[model samples]
Target: MPLTKEDVAGIADYARIALTPEELDEMTAYMNDAIDLLEPIRQYDLEGVEPTFHPIGDLSNVMAGDVPDTSVRALPLDAALRNAGSSRDRCFRVPSILGDQGGDR
Candidate 1:
């Protein structure tokens, strides 16, 4: 269904969006136009056509041999920790939110 200005305003209020009057009207028109455009698709005769699960051309799993390739570079611990907000012993540290870490449980 096409949305009304009141409907858009209600949604904006629910989402805590501060929309200007002009923006509200624009968004309402866009929402209504989207709904109106979709209406024609429902009238199509798609009775017997099997619903396609994936729209892209046929997909198949490309499998490879499980042999390990070891060209990946590992950064030094100190270099990796340079950009962290907090670190200890060359490791990035973060607040322990889980209670077990603080023995609070």
Candidate 2:
């Protein structure tokens, strides 16, 4: 059935939207047009068509194989920390924004 202005307005009100009169009329027309377009598809005879995951038959996944990359090697602790501008107790040391927030520096 085609949607009326009242239907559109009710739906907008239920959805907690504040639509102007022009917008409500436009939405009503849009909904009615959509219903008209879908009216022809209501008489299809696909009684035995099996439910399908993919629309095309026998489609394989295009994903790359899940394997750990071995080309890049892990860095040693010292090597990782070598480029740090400042580090303390094997961790980064940044300038304290909040003075004595945690404890005595």
lDDT of each: 0.83, 0.83
lDDT tens readout by residue for model 1, 1-105: 678889999999999998999999999999888888889899999989988888764676567878755687767677788889988775677777764564422
| Cα lDDT tens digits for candidate 2, 1-105 | 688899999999999998999999889988888888887787787799887887786878877888856787867768878888888778767778887687635
Among all windows of 10 consecutive residues in model 1, the one with the lowest summed lDDT is 96-105
Model 1, C-alpha of 9: deviation from truth (Å):
0.5
Positional deviation of residue 89's Cα in model 1 after best superposition, in angstroms: 21
**Each prediction's TM-score versus the true structure:** 0.41, 0.46
Number of residue pairs clashing in candidate 1, backbone atoms closer than 3 angstroms, sequence gap of 3 or more or interchain = 0
Once fitted onto the true fold, the runs of candidate 1 whose alpha carbons sit more than 4 angstroms away are 45-105
- Model 1 CA lDDT for position 86: 89
Cα RMSD (angstroms) for every candidate in the order listed:
8.8, 6.6
| Candidate 1 residue-wise lDDT at 17 | 97
Q: What total of clashing residue pairs does each candidate reach? A: 0, 0
